[model samples]
Target: MKRTTLALLGLVSLAACAQAPQGAAADAAGSQAATAQAPAPAPKAAPRPDTPEGRALAALRELDPNIEPDRLRAAPIPGFREAIVSGQTLYVSDDGRYVFIPGVNGALFDIRQQKNLSEASLASLRRELLQEIPKSERIVFAPPDPKYTVTVFTDVECGYCRKLHQEIAEYNRQGIAIEYLAFPRMGLGSEDYRKMVAVWCAPDRRRALTDAKNDRPVPVRECKTTVNQQYALGQRVGLTGTPMILAPDGTQLGGYVPPRQLRERLDKLAQGGAGAGAP
Candidate 1:
């Protein structure tokens, strides 16, 4: 989802093609073979304190107590070092005097390749983090043979979210599995949050979600639920609206796409083409 053994080509070529005197050539070949087979030296460790990377790691630790400094490394940007903490990337200056958080303006695009490097990295991170979510916590509508899957952050009261839900069958038919994660736009303790909890706690969660999205009452019997956790995850991933679709690779598709168009886009992505349709 994300290297092969290296053959000693030079040694092999020399052995195959060289025609030197017998004993000397054999001795030389043996020496060369031994050298080639020897394990490569281990990489040198980063220098200790007083070094730029060291200072950056120290500063990052102060800023985020949970950061694992071992993960920090010099970034392509000359003065900045990058680290991933809780699936989000952070950049700190070599001198430990400046810190940068990725944002809309910070999203670097490779115009030649027509790709958003920042978004791609973030998407991969999101996928890694989201993989921890148990299937039991989601309301999933999957086809018999789903070719692609999408995780949608949805709110019961959001009109577009409801529209997406209404077409859930169509999405499934298109071989696109839909996994719903509750995102109560209204904060915790609000009616929307409570309703989402009710839906999540329902014995038949898929049906409950469908009914709730249709504005029908779901039995308000709350038990243990991950609705709040899902909302928090949505926030962590920078979700600002309901019906936000996350493709299988964690690419955020932003908003709703018509079923056929969504399927076509998924196909293109599967074929190694860039993501189609706006976010």
Candidate 2:
């Protein structure tokens, strides 16, 4: 699927989620704290139904009745509102007559700031979503006190994914931590997904992942896994291929860049400058 298509699916998924009952309960202590503080201050009033946010939210509900109201907000562009559905960024007209995605017609650039406004929004969304993945759920390779960390959505059967694994030490040496999440290019029920499940379930996940990437046999193992969740996450972040590398702040640094080149790009980002060229 194309990135745009995956992004649309992400929004659809959010609508779907709203119709389903929540699987986890709110923390008791957290709920109590909220309740205790409720009487101290007046609750903010809901937006008027005629307001921009309200109109946008209403229009979104026409698309899917379950879109959470909290996801809608004023957009950077005047006369529009932005909705964060799942991890996708969508812009809705204030009148609620239209919706648009960044990079649909052309790049949405902020000339004064010299930045791609759409990409910036998407990057922030990606970063926030990625940070929510628990450390234990990722297979990581890193140097002590790494200077930077990147999350990579990978398929064990992908050639470039294997190539990147071969140079894992170099990435670590460059003080770049690599966090791996499964994104089996083959669908969920494919052999590739099963192999990834084994890798994640292994006693030594790091080694097992490397072994799978190297085409070595991994003993079939089954346990509760996050492979499916991570794959769905990949789609939400506009992933269209394996080995999609994302910087700490959610900028896509692209696929399988050599360690030195990858480090150079990261260094530029660290120094608050755009990289030499698109990754």
Q: Give me the candidate number with maximum lDDT.
A: 2
| TM-score, every prediction | 0.62, 0.62
Q: With candidate 2 superimposed using the best TM-score fit, by how many Å does residue 233's alpha carbon deviate from the native?
A: 0.2
**Candidate 1 lDDT over residue span 1-279, tens digit each:** 000001111111233455668998789877996788889877546558798878776665554344454367789888888866544566767777655556553443332344556677888888887876788898899999998889999999999999898888899889899998989998899999999999998899988888898889999987988777888899887787787898888877658888898998787777776554233
Tens digit of lDDT per residue, candidate 2, span 1-279? 223333344434554455433433445544876777666654446567899888887766665666664457788999899888765677878887666656432334332243445567888999888976799999999999999999999999999999999999999999999999999999898998999999999999999998898889999999999889998999998888888999888988878899999999889878776442233
Q: In model 1, which residue pairs have backbone atoms overlapping below 3 Å?
A: none
**Candidate 1 accuracy as TM-score:** 0.62
Span of ten consecutive residues with least summed lDDT in model 2:
104-113
What number of clashing residue pairs does each candidate have, in the order they appear? 0, 0
Evaluated against the true structure, the overall lDDT of model 1 is 0.74
* Model 1 stretches astray by more than 4 angstroms: 1-106
Q: In model 2, what are the clashing residue pairs, if there are any?
A: none
Q: How many residue-pair clashes does candidate 2 contain?
A: 0
